[model samples]
Target chain A: MDYLVTHSPALIVALPLLAAFAIPLISRLGPRVRAVLCLAVLGLVAALVAILAVDVHAVGIRLYTFGATAPEMALPGGYMVPVRIMFEVDGMSIFMGIVITTVAVASLIYSLQFLNGQTGQARFYSLMMLLYVGMMGLAFTGDMFNMFVFLEIASIAGTGLAAYRTNMADAVEGGFKYIVISAVSALMVLLAIGILYAQYNVLSIAALAHYMQYTTLDMMALGLLAGAFVMKLAGVPLHMWAPDTYTVAPAGTTPMILAASYTSMYALYRITFTLYGGHIDTAAIGWIVIIVGVLSMFVGVMMAVHQTDIKRMMAYHAISQGGYMLLGVGVGLAVIADPVALANYGRDAMNGGIFHIINHVFYKAMLFMTAEAIFFRVGTRDTNKMGGLARNMKWTAIFYAIGALAISGIPPFNGFASKLLIYQTVLSFNPVLSVIAMFVSLVTLASFAKVFYSAFTGPEMPGYKEVREVPKSMLIGMGILAACIILFGIFPGLIVDTIVAPATEALINQAPYINAVMGAAP
Target chain B: MSALSYEAYAVWVPIVWVAALVVIGVIVLAWRNRGQKSYKKGTAQTDIFLSGIKVPPEEQRHVKAENVYWGFFEALKGFYSVLMRPHTGVVNDYILWFVALVAVAILILVLGA
Candidate 1:
């Protein structure tokens, strides 16, 4: 128990990676054995993440160094530089870990029945586990180059999964586009890493932060990292791939893909807050993020209203919801220099943004699952052709309604809690931004209302009268997320106090993070 | 000061609105029924308004999903036109947009520096 608790950071990532490799061999046992193996692996990963979260909150940051005598012994004898790779498990990393693991377990369970009897089950399970490994590594790694490596692993796994349905031309096309964009953006990230390495001769993020001078090369690298990550997160203008990819990917995989996108968003936050803290022009970068966010919100929602395909519309909403996070955090960044403002509103804005990330993982996953349930029964995603499904699929309708209400920011759901915080804080920072956020929420509601009325309500269509409800396992998968949406909505305070506050403090206080890895940071 | 004080922000407002709507609906129903002795089922009173044009039963039951927000769409036609044009669903166009945004980001960062 002691060893597991102590070295769990490395184990959490390594266990799944090893399991992923063993899956193909396990497939010879049969589909049922492979399915159980996938679930057990993800389930253990979820347990480890929960324990890590509890441990992180109880203790301080946990740093595990590879190929070294001690965790902090990054330097060799008589050497003045650190070359060892380390994983730093802070409050933020643990929080993201919990989100990823929860979604992974639920999606994998859902896929058990959702992708049952499909060909390439072994390959699918392997790719799913590898994807989890990438996200976990990216979240916990304290090294910059390692972050890139993990990112490429995730991108490749994700591209393979996105293109998994090889029969459909659109699925292939979407996968090709996704890989192209991901590969290009990753190259840019590598270029930025190379630039940083060239100048500082160090790849450790903490070491780089300690010696940051905000020089010309550092500025260029910052721009490149920021651009690549924002594109990866599908911020508008760069969001065209999202609708295409989301529309064609297997229903169970869409939520995982969404989680991958959040990992990129996490990278953006980590880079700006910890890697470049107090070294750059906060106001300038804040404005840049705010502009991109505003554009994403407006453009994403406006485009969604015109979409007839259910998944495509939800993809647009994903971009729009991402905008809220950006807007809230950007407001915090914009006012970081003003202590008065930071205390007054910036803290709340940051909390809202971070909280929304967790809230989004639940409700959006539920929404996509419901969309998948519809597709499972109706064999189509076009809303124009769907109608009166609620008559047959009672649980799915109820679940879809809950998800729709939660996402639209109606009260007593998690979205309302987070969006309300964002609204109040952004209102304090700039009334115009608050108003825009509210307008975007309204449009989101209107668009979802269209989805509900079209897909679930009205008279029974001619062919759908005989349609039966989806399988039980699929409902269970969606139920977990629905329960979370309700739980987080009612107890936002508890969640904030326990997880979000510590995560926020970890983001704000950069000195300790650097000190943990660099031995007091001189 | 509390970042998560949701209750302090009138969390019951949605419930209250829902209750008020239910009460108003009941009162309206009572007032409108004051002079009526009885009502017939599926007669002229229950018939859906179709601008006084007679329609077949199948056509009468048909409701178009896209037409639900006709008025709203009409009001935002110009905005919709601009927003819809760029969603070309073409891969090259998507890549172009990403590249353009990267250029814009670099330009801004350099200028800020």
Candidate 2:
């Protein structure tokens, strides 16, 4: 047990990658066997994450170096340079861990049923595991180049999964667009890493931070990294591929793909808070982030309100919701230089942003699953072709209702918990941004209301009269996220104290992050 | 239950809101249950009344998804036109937007420094 807790970080990433490779061979045993194997791997990964989270909470940051004589030896033989690839399990990384594992478990279970009759089932599961590995590595890796490598892995695997349904031309086009966007963004990330490597002579993030001088080159790298990650996260203007890709992604994988987007978001936060901490112009960068967020919030909803395709509309909403996170964190970044302002509301804004990450993942993933559920039964993604599905798919309708309400920030749901935090804190920072966020939330509710009435309520369509509730496995999948939504909502304080606070602290204060790898700065 | 807040700015105890909602829901349900229960099922009393206009078929009476916000769309047509201009769905245009943002970001960073 002690060994497992100590080495869980490396194991969590390695297990999924190995399982992804071994699954195809294991599938020859039988479909059921393959399914069991997939679940076992994902279950173990989830358990590892839970264990890691507990350990991280109990004992500050947990470091595991890959090639060191000792797992915790970031710098071997007292060398001034730390060259080994290391896994730094900090609060923020573990927070993302919780999210990735939760979504992975639900998505794997959901896929088991959703892809029952499809070919390439083994390949799909393999790619899913690979995506999981990519996200995990991206979260935990302390190396810049390794982060880029993991980013590419996720992008490739995600593109493959996005284009899984090659039978449709739109699916192919969507996949093409996704890869194109991913390729451009990823290249920028790689270039930025190269620029940083050229200057710092090391790829370890902590070591680089300790050596950071915030030179012109460093700011250039920051620009490239920030742009790449923001684009990857689907912040507006660069979000065009999101709707096309999400609308056609096979069921169950869409949520995992969404998690990948949030992983990009995690990368963005890392760059600004950890990588560039206290070096750059906080207000300038913060306002830049805020403007991007504001545009996304308004433009995303504007596009969503007119979308007739259910998944397409939800995709736009995803962009809009992302804006809330950026706004919260942006406010924190803006005020970090002012200790007085930081205490008054900046801390809360960061807390809200971090907390909303998990809440948004749970409810938004479930909402995507519900949209896919609708597509599964009625064989249409167009809302004009769906109505009164509530009568037949009662469980699905209930799940959808829970997700919609939670996402719209309706009282007592998880979205409300996080949005309330963002709202009040952001209000203290600036009233206009708060009002814009509130307006975005209202429009979000109206947009979802339209989808609910169109897809679930009203008179029963003759064509869907025979539609029955989705299979039990799919329900269990959504049920996991729904349960999380309710649990997190009812006990927002517990979650914030346990996980969100730690993450917020980890991001805002870079001293701890740097010292964990490179000893206390002189 | 502790509230999810770091300061005295505001408190959001969702459990309290949830309990209140449940209480109000039960009261509303009880009030609704007190209504007259003698109405006949499947009779003319249950038939649709459209103010003397002939009732359309059930399916036809339902509003389609596209028409849900017809008025809102009309009111925001100019704004939407400006918004929709960039969403040309072409791959090159998408890349163009990305490159444009990158340039703007690099400029800002360089200038600010």
Candidate 3:
């Protein structure tokens, strides 16, 4: 029964794709009806995601293979029957599922008025729905090639969303850069997949991991894969695309885009740990990845510190925060290849990395949404031109401040908790790593201080002087994120144990992944 | 038992890695701290590039970042021009980057195979 329910992971993927198509068509019939329909799909998605999260919690492993035959779990004595297209739901998938759906529900509800008031709102909702489809697809996919397809689908849809405000030249430029960079990244992914397919004759990641059997393909696939995902993950040198796109995208779509892409990063983890068998030595590629991560962290924060544009600054900080997440994951990978190291600090590093990702998605999305609200109210994303508007938009200021604190890793905010975990993990491994992570945190704090001072605290400029508070719907969206930010910040353990642990386990435990696809237990 | 070259490059790679990392770390830290911090009381040789560049109390400020990477590009100006690159503001350079990337990938994979 669980298998039947789980295999229907396509529904998680399909609901939004179907909704996206349905939204624009329904909007033509009636605007009010469109709102209700979008909300209904959102509600259904949230409920289903919650149900799946519960299933993952109760059961250690749940496999949902598409197009079912007699469901079989072969024991040690029996050989395997290949039932390919599957969604393996463990703890991590569920946590990400919950976060994605919850944010979708909130963002869509907020966009009701926000989009309704704007022109071509039907198109906006459709793009957003497709965006959700891509993200949910990412969270649930247990394979790599399919991950790229969804990545492409999401990226193209995101480009359209960024360009929705067609009146602005910068917005159009952002969209162009976004599409071009993402296309290149996607090309890299396709080439990498081609390489893997030629070698393995399989598209399923779990099968490939089993087939690896500790061969050259292990390193080859990984080396190829790291570059492919490095572009997607926006690690350092490849991160040039993110700032411009995020800065110029639609106000309502900003958070959703970050949430979607970040989920892809989570998928990268699923590929590395679950599909690749977590068998390769971290020493192979660990240093290169760590250096890139560290550089991104420092560079992101440094550039962010200098930006007068609020959205652009946040974009740089997003790149930096992404570095923190990657740094932890990279460290964990380094040691996971060695049995002795895996037992000690490797698990901690992995824990910190995954934890930071979850914390990051919520806080970062909220931060972006907060930026959006400010944009809607002021008609600009420039922080230097405006000040003292916080007094007028009190709730927004509070929410923005909460996000600012959280992103800076300030105590009791979600960012601080995960960052602390990362720092602790890195410290246990190497003194230098701890210093770098802490330095990133400090840089993050300093950048946000600049944001607060310039954007919210300075004297109210001419245009913003009369700007009023945004719609209640927008506040509700932020309010939900604000609560989660506080909730996760204070009780990092809950998030760690329930969500992070299972996902981490699924990533670390190569046995089931390989065993599922291949007949033998290696 | 595996054909993976884990040992062949081990000794040199580790030393090189350590040296590169130390150098990179110091460089990154220096770049992050590159700005006005009020340190000197100096001479007529103080220019914008000099740390002791004299200015009225308010005239001094951090360098604008829009053109911060100008020097690096200036050094590569002739090469970038040949490639028709950097600030052409044309979308074709981006397309070329993709083409070159894919070409490199194909070459590597054919060899790897």
Q: Candidate 1: deviation at residue A417, Å?
A: 0.6
Per-residue lDDT tens digits of candidate 1, residues A183-271?
Answer: 99999999999999999999998888888888878888888898899988999878888988877888788888899999999899989
In model 2, which runs have C-alpha deviations exceeding 4 angstroms? A520-522, B1-11
- Which sections of candidate 1 miss by over 4 Å? A76-78, A520-522, B1-4, B7-52, B58-60
- The DockQ figures for the candidates are 0.40, 0.59, 0.03
For model 1, how does the per-residue alpha-carbon lDDT over B17-104 read when each residue is reduced to its tens digit? 4567679999999998796667788788867677878755642364556777889889999988888789888888877877787777
Best model number under DockQ:
2
Q: How well is candidate 1 docked (DockQ)?
A: 0.40
Please give fnat for model 3.
Answer: 0.01
- Quality of candidate 1's docking, in CAPRI categories? acceptable
lDDT scores of the candidates, listed in order: 0.86, 0.89, 0.71
lDDT of 3 by residue, A1-522 (tens): 565365446677788799899887898888889888988888877777777777777765566666555323322234243436666666667767877787777678667767655788888889999988887777776666778887888888899999898999989998898788777777767776777778777776666666665455445555556555666666665666778788998766877777766776777677667766445444644665578789889878766766678888898898999888888888877777677776666776777788887788777777888788888878778765556778688888898899888898876677876776677668877889789878878867877876776667644555566888888888888888889987886566667777777767767676765565564444
In order, the first chain's TM-score in every candidate is: 0.98, 0.99, 0.93
lDDT of 2 by residue, A265-353 (tens): 99999989998897988988888888888988999988998999999999999999899899989999999999888888888898888
lDDT of 3: 0.71
